[model samples]
Target: MPAITVSRRQALLGTATVAAAAALSGLPPSRTLARAPFAAAQAPYYYRFAHGKMQATVVSDGILPLGDPSGTFLGTSKEEIGKMLTDNFLSTASVVLEQNILVLNTGDRLVLFDTGMGSSQLFGPTPGKMLANLKAAGIDPKDIDAVVATHAHCDHVWGIMSDDGSRNFPNAQIYISQADFDYWTDEAKLAIKEPAFMNAFIAGARKNLLPNRDRLVFVKDGQEFLPGIQAISAPGHTVGHTIYMITSDGKTLAAIGDLTHHQVLLLEKPRIEFAFDTDPKQSANTRVRILDMLAANRIPLIAYHFPWPGVGHVAKQGDGFRYYPTPLQMVLDQKG
Candidate 1:
């Protein structure tokens, strides 16, 4: 793949039209397209439904830097990985970390799954667009009835709090798995061999959840978060990473949070676990189970890290899986 260096000015111009549209419609400034030149191309947000009335929107918060891929996935050969990246029109060895947040509008209530990294230095200017996107979709944070977290990972949980350390969604009740909450908050777990990263996670949890403890609800596996959203326990990514099932009308969508970081490498090679997974073996097993279920049931998926507008269907391609993105443009055109 050729190296594409987008200029900052071009980036800003590309995003300006979207920002202008949001402004004309009285949306928040954050959702305004970045004025920065195009350092990298931006992906569009998308929406679809499970059942019929339940609406799911994929709002992209932003992308994170791609670090080295060495030793990340199990049995992943650098040469093979490079070939796969090239095949996907991406540069070998450089993995762009895409951050996605899902909004499910279940008629009576609006729920968001996994907040994105909120206005942090790590996310640059594109950070904290979830709220803006929500507004663009005619959703008010105050209108959100609940916020469900897959795990306590920084990217997944940080958006729960604003830059000034306040709950972003003032009216929403926060829900997280009991296992994930205990693991990140446990001092013993924080003092694991890799204390540094654990400490950072601990700090983030304190900053995001400690003060609002009363409003936060700890969920158990198999519990129903809403009429159509059921919590599915699929641990190993963290202590309690979860996959939320939204079954409505006649279709189903699984909001699988951080089950796998890289779609191509992870989906195509289900057994190869990333280094970030707490228990690679268990994570791999969970991925395999979810992939098998998705293929068997022919259900759509909303992944936190699969390319932007991360709503897609998974298909069994021989021994592996393939992602079939539900293109936002096509959906929008049909809606029109």
Candidate 2:
């Protein structure tokens, strides 16, 4: 008989088959012979949920990592904040807030609430991914019917336009309180504020708001800005800082924009002021009032500055309130 002529491929195939069979038979398996590169990209950060008859999507605008909660949040001692953060198992060195932007589809119209930080690196470079995340959610900017800003802050209104000054949501009508619009964007107010900080805030506001002045719809408290979307004026964070009451088929969710910055720092100590608030005392009043109502009624809210996909409930605990983030519904329910 001729000597067996097994090619290198045949020999490798035979060895693989034996290893597979041995593994299936409960034998020890071979280890990986080569190294593999780790994953560099992340999955899409958008989360979608049922909103009564409509649909809601929470898209990541990345994160706003404010350095040192003690300085950014005041009306409380540094020691107090440090202890609170440590107790809660949160990072005590810095305060990181998620830019969880909300978008709604009311069948008749598509609405986007509070555009995230556009390209401004004033708070560092982590944020400004709203457009990318929005697209990842299968939403096209031109398809949005309304772009509502809870206030005129850079994190909220700056994303209205691209860096080149073109409308990011070209077809969508803009909605924002005239007070915030005028206050933040006014060149006159810039003179009084410290240029180091307020300059970019005002400049970004003007770059994103002034060009759309002719098309901007001034938001009125208690009025329905769009179908199923009502504006609720929750001031103090700014002159016209507002929160929105989104309702559909009897179900409602409060979109509290900057009403509270941190769950442990602000919510648990509702009176403690955030350094970013234009009027700390007034903001504390508003925070307590809105948080109190939400707690009593067990209403759910989406905090723009809360953890990612900030859909949760607030409950009165001890002297203040406690936040409970709802477990995300990764799959569609029977209704969907």
Candidate of highest TM-score: 2
Cα RMSD to native, each candidate? 11.7, 6.6
Report the lDDT tens digits of candidate 1 across residue range 1-336. 223445766778778977787789998757635576665833435455443666666677777665556545556788888777788887665577777888887888889898887766553565566777777667778887899999987888888888686778899899998788877767655566573466777777767877778898888788886788899999888888988998877667888888878778888888876877878889889888888988899887878888876778889887789989875644432541
C-alpha lDDT of all candidate models, in order: 0.78, 0.88
- TM-score for candidate 2, please give it: 0.90
Each prediction's TM-score versus the true structure: 0.81, 0.90
lDDT by residue for model 2 over 259-296, one digit each (tens)? 99898889888999887788999999999999999999
The list of candidate 2 runs beyond 4 A from truth reads 1-36, 334-336
Question: Which residues of candidate 1, in runs, are more than 4 Å off?
Answer: 1-51, 122-126, 189-196, 329-336
Top lDDT hit:
2
Residue 331, model 1: Cα distance from true site in angstroms: 5.5
